[model samples]
Target: MNTKQLIEEAVSLPLEERAIVVDSLLRSLNQPESEIDKQWANEAKRRLSELRSGHIEAIPGNDVFSKVWDRFEK
Candidate 1:
């Protein structure tokens, strides 16, 4: 089917199905690189290990956001 016809059919789908279709289309246009994803996963694991081991202290989200807002207001 043509683009217009395809769009009409997609629009007729149920909300959940439409979301799946949209996500599929977006993923197709922006494919993730497995190597970069793996690197990010490793970094996340390292950070979590550090936090658990007390090698680094976790900052409270409220304090972080307050500092950010304070900087912006200056």
Candidate 2:
């Protein structure tokens, strides 16, 4: 129904479901043609092209996360 009712219903949802609702709501607030989206799209395409052309190597997710944790974790 209205915003208040919608918010109350969303809050009553389970934690994971509430998080999905919040994420979707936040996404809706952004314009698809915004500069940020265009930049991300271009970056994604560039990464995909690089992977296909072998211009750069793709690191495993675990390796990437391990590097991040090694740098940031105490």
Candidate 3:
């Protein structure tokens, strides 16, 4: 549908449904990737490289969470 008709239909939705529709519509718009995503992608590449080169360390999940909680609860 054309923009005006589409907007009219969106406005005619019930209040809550209209809000959901608007939020979904806005979120469907293109967004640029964040810098953290780029950094994570690079780090993943480095890790894969290290794994291929047989250089790796295994850390338990409990240890990771303990460290995270220590800093988080501080």
lDDT of all predictions: 1.00, 0.92, 0.88
Model 2 lDDT tens row, 14-68: 9999999988888899747788788999999999999999999989999999999
Give the per-residue lDDT of model 3 (tens digit) for 1-74. Answer: 99999989989989999999978877689564789789999999999998788898767999999999999998
Please estimate how well model 2 matches the true structure, expressed as its whole-model Cα lDDT: 0.92
Name the candidate, 2 or 3, with the larger lDDT value: 2
Every model's Cα RMSD, please? 3.3, 4.3, 8.2
List candidate 2 segments past 4 Å from native. Answer: 1-24
Report model 1's TM-score to 2 decimal places: 0.62
- What TM-scores do the predictions have? 0.62, 0.54, 0.38
**Model 2 TM-score, 2 decimals:** 0.54
Error of 2 at 6 (Å): 6.6
Q: What's the CA RMSD of model 2 in angstroms?
A: 4.3
Q: Model 3, poorest ten-residue lDDT window?
A: 24-33
Q: Could you tell me which residue pairs clash in candidate 2?
A: none
